[model samples]
Target: MAWMYLVIGGLMEVLWAIGLKYSDGFSHPLISVLTIIGIVTSFYFFSRALKYLPVGTAYAIFTGLGAAGTAIIGMVYLGESISYIKLFFILLLISSIVGLKLNAKVEA
Candidate 1:
């Protein structure tokens, strides 16, 4: 359950990040509002996950998921540059996140 919350939070983090891009420097009213909601919602979920997960491990995975998801979305949806080096690091970051999850000591 905590992991689920963490994943949701991470996904929302990705969403808000992309939202920021589409918000046109917060000039687009609807996108900007949605982005603000995303920010609050993501933090809500992240706070829920912190109840059962270590701060360091949860934070690392949370930010890692956000980073990886945003990068992938940028390339696929936003037509950003894709390079071998970028792919390599994204994979590395993902693997590291999984490793942290595997070794994490859940409090409940």
Candidate 2:
């Protein structure tokens, strides 16, 4: 359950990130409002997960998903380049996130 919340938070992080891109430095009213909403919702879920998960583990996973998801979205929808180097690093980030999840032990 905690992991689920964490994952949702991470996805919200991605939405907020993309929202920021469209917000034009907050000059765009609708996008900016949605971005703010995303931010609040993301943090709410993140905090909920933190009640059960280790701070460091949860935070790393949260931000890692956000970073990787944002990059992929940018490439797919925003005309961002997907070079070998970028792909390699994105994979590395994903690998590290997986590694952290595998190593994390939930408190009993």
Candidate 3:
């Protein structure tokens, strides 16, 4: 369940990140509102997951997932160029998150 929340939070992080591009520095009211909602909801789930997961481990995983997910979305939907160097770093980030999840023993 904690992992589920973490995944949802990561996805919300992606939404908020993409929302920023459309926000026009918060000038676009609708997207700005959605961005705020996304950020708030993302943090709520992240905080909930922290109740059962270690802070250091959970936070690292959360941010890593956010960064990687947002980068992928930007590349695919926003047509942002994904260079080989950036891809390598993103893969490294994913590996680190997976390692932490595999190594950490979170209680339900």
* Highest lDDT scorer: 1
The C-alpha RMSD in Å for every predicted model, in order, reads 0.6, 0.9, 1.0
Q: Give lDDT: candidate 1, residue 64.
A: 99
Question: In candidate 3, which residue ranges exceed 4 Å CA deviation?
Answer: none
* lDDT tens digits by residue: candidate 3, 12-96: 9989988998999999999999999999999999998998999899999999999999998888888999899999999999999
Per-residue CA lDDT of candidate 2, range 1-108, in tens? 888999999999999999999999999999999999999999999999998889999999999999999999999999999999999999999999999889987765
> Candidate 3 local accuracy as lDDT?
0.92
Per-model lDDT: 0.98, 0.96, 0.92
Pull out the clashing pairs in model 2: none
Q: Give the Å shift of residue 98 in candidate 3.
A: 0.4
Model 3, residue 22: distance off in Å is 1.1
Candidates 1 and 2 compared: the better one by TM-score is 1
Question: Which candidate leads in TM-score?
Answer: 1
Better of 2 and 3 by TM-score: 2
Greater-TM-score candidate between 1 and 3: 1
lDDT of 3 at 46: 96
Please give the lDDT score at residue 44 for candidate 1: 99
